[model samples]
Target: MKKEKQYINIFIIFLFILVSLLMIIPLVRNGRINAYSDWTFHSARVQQIYLNLQRGNLLTFIATDVSQHTGVGTFLFYPYLFLYPWAIFKLVVSPVTAFYLWYASITLLTLIISYYSMMRFSKENYVQSLIFAFVYMLVPYRLYLGQVVLGEFIAATFLPLVFLGLYEILWGDLKKWYLLSIGMSLLVYSHILSVYLSCQVIALIFAGYLILSKISIKRIKVLLYSAILTIFLSLPVVVLFITDFIGKGIATTFTGIAIEPEFNSVIVDSFRNWNGFNIGLILMVTFIIGGVIVRKNKQLKYIYVLGVLLTIAATSVVPWYMFSNTILGKVQLTNRYFSFGDLFLAVIASYGLSRLFDKKLDIVRKSILMFLISIGSVFIFYASSTWVLQETHTYNKELYLLLQPKKKNGVPKIPDRVQLDNNNYNYQFEYRSLTGSSDYYPIKAYDNQSKVDSILNQETYINGKRRKLIGRYNTNTIKYRISLKSKSRVDLPVIKYNHTEVYVNNNLIKNSRISDRGTIDLTLDKGMNNINIKYQPNFSFYTCVIISAIIWLLLFIYIVKVW
Candidate 1:
């Protein structure tokens, strides 16, 4: 029995490797790289982290080149967990190769984690576990997401682990609470929007478990502990996001006019937009078949029901507009809920296959089942390979050239006379600039373009003054000398955050404030005023980071010892 099990494991490992290779056929064929939508942007973010580390900055929050060199807190608002591995890979390899390596690692990890998670749920049913993990990895919607949205792909990859952990906590051992904590933390770290959607699903699962099974105080305690631990582990990133959101008033107001459209159109559009390959029908049918097959298993039945409901909710059936106008708008998309649905459907399909391959089955039936499985496997490979090839070809033809690095002789010298034009400068070529948008920077050119143009023609001027560009300027800090002809207010073109501080002639300016356009407004005195601007995080940010690091270290030690 042991030898047979070892052989099965070997075969499964081989199968996993074969599938992984099939998935990467497009990437291997290209020899170049896949610069699909958002790939360049994400790659650039990883590059920023690498550059920051090279500059001796450990905790990098500000993107120096964003907002046309004014800098923006990109990492401050975005999750950094997924980017860390890619950034580390970039240290030893080329950026493009590092990206591919990151994707490959993630894909492999997804398969391994899913397979293990399924094994935990299926107990001795190793074949069923293998099938579940394989199906989950190759789910068409997930593959489609991998090509476009990486964060969602990562979050989706871990969904099975999260569910398995949750299941263990609710229905299995109380000692496995740590699994839930780790899973929840990983999900939160991978993507903030995913975290929000995942919380809703978890809540539904918890409620369903309560309805279906008897709960004990011990189980409740485990659940609470897991929740608390998850929050504690993710506190640093969560605090940073909340602090930035509150500082920016992002949730209070809607920038655009809210238009109410017909309900049917909204639902149809939502489904159409998210369902890349119309895989919803296959998922629905498989889920029903699996639910029927696993009707006796209470746990599987609950999962099937959860999947059906989530799948429906992901469509236009729910009043998304209401949620969008309210707190749920922060998530930006209701369709993301489909990922959870897909996960459940995959589990159900695995159960159905397990039932079909039961020992009691006749030889003829077993042969037919094996043949059907073979055909399905071939179809999945063909479909996935074709999809990847098409997507890669389309991306290479269109976006690959745009992201290609251009050779430069040397750093371009900054012009002595800097123009504060209201017209948006295209920063596509300005790789050094942290942000591509100019909306945050405050300038005098909005109403006085002619005046700004006149000043730009002069030997030394930004706002009708002889301002000498002095000192070293980088993403985090800017230093310049303003030889103001007279005592005048000099507005520095920089996006203002709560932590942005300005100092003139080595003295910190008390009343330095952010303008309506999100730039720093500095009141200057006559004579050569040495101006210095810096982005400094608050005490809370430091405290959170230190605490988070300590907690993570302790968790790592505990996990190592326990495992």
Candidate 2:
């Protein structure tokens, strides 16, 4: 029996890999590389992280190649942990291949983790676990999310493990509370929006469980410990995120367009148009059946109820305005609720399958039921494939052509000033000016061309003293040979950030300030001055990261020894 079980587990893993590969068929088919809507955006981010890592900057908070001329703080504001795997892969492979590998690897991981989590809850019902994993992976909403929203796709990969941890903490072994911390930390790092949505769902599940099961002191203590650990482990990220928010406001704003008061055409369109809410007939039936069969199981019952609530919230009838217009609007869209809904429904469907198998049924009846279920599975697969292919074709035909690499015919000359063009998407302006030109200029310089040109061209003066730009250049350091006739303040085309540092000759400049146009303003000494401008992480950021790393290591050790 042990040997047979081992073989079955091997086969299940093989199936997962096969299914993951099949989902990428559209990308691999016809020997072509396809681009999704957000592929360029994500690819640019990955390239930035990889290049920064290669440059010996281990902790990347400031991205110097976005926002046209003036760089933006990417990692400082956005959740970039999801892109780390791609950056690591890029160390060994091409950027494009690394992206494909990242996507495929996440898909496979999601399936494997989903299966194990389901098995834990279902008492090792292998067949049902496999089915749930398959359904969850191929859910239309999840597929659509992968094509357009990489962050959400990455966050969904950890949802199962989160529920697994929550289940153990709330009802099972109290010592397993660490699982919740691990899962929540990963989710928080993956996407802020997903974290917000996940917290709401977890809260609903906890509430439902409280209503169903007798409340015990141990459970409450375990729950509080798990929450505290999760928050503690996530402190660095949370602090960074809040700091960015306070400095730059939320990354997005609510426009009141996504709210709908009635469940009518718009709601129908979201389901019918493959907009990340389509549950499909098969999973819906299984979910309902599972809820009925497992009505007595407290944990499963809460999950089922959570699924129903999420499903309703995903629709247009819900008062999304309250959430969307408030601080929660940073999440951007209410449709993201469907991702969590699909997760719970998939688990419920698996429970239903396990229950169906546990009952004593005649062979003929079992055979008939199996046949119908198999047919339903095929239908879902066909529908999902069709949608993926259509999306791929549309993306390839419309956007892929624009993204083809343009060859530099000759050594391109750099303009006197970095041209802040309208083509800011994918950092196209930066890429062209930096990589396709011979001269050195800030790739993402300040957008005000006139101001930048004034700063870069001609001489700068301070306190009625003039300084001449004898020689200006850049390598790892922005170098300048300034013939300062008299001691004067001169401005350099480097964006000012918390991490920016300037040095005169070899000594650190103690009083460098940002200019009105966001460049570094430095006071230069008389005679030829060698100025170097660079970005270095502050001690506080490093301390936060180091502390988080230590906690992560300790958590890993605890999980390995105890779990």
Give the poorly placed runs of model 2, Cα more than 4 Å off: 30-37, 53-58, 65-69, 91-94, 210-212, 235-277, 284-299, 354-382, 385-387, 390-398, 401-495, 504-507, 515-531
Clashes of each: 8, 3
Where model 1 places Cα greater than 4 Å from the true spot, the runs are: 1-18, 31-37, 247-284, 358-382, 385-388, 394-475, 478-483, 527-532
lDDT of 1: 0.62
Report the Cα lDDT for residue 85, model 1.
85
Whole-model Cα lDDT per candidate?
A: 0.62, 0.62
lDDT of 2 by residue, 209-321 (tens): 77877888888888788888887788778766554445532223223436332335434433453434566554556445656766788666767877777766776677676
Clashing pairs in 1: 65-433, 65-434, 65-435, 66-433, 66-434, 66-435, 67-435, 267-316
TM-score of each: 0.77, 0.75
Candidate 1 lDDT over 1-563, as tens digits, reads 67756665665666666556555555645444433444444555676677766777766666554322444555666667788888888788755456666776777778778888888888857657767776776666676667556778888878887888888888876666788788878887787678778888888877767777787778888888888988888887778766665656322212222333333553443334232532333454675466677779876777787777777666556677667656666555555766888788778887886765675555456445544553465456455556445544533333333321433332122221121111211222243321112222224332343432222222233454434342444647767777766777665555566677788899998868654434566767778998777788788888887887788899889878986
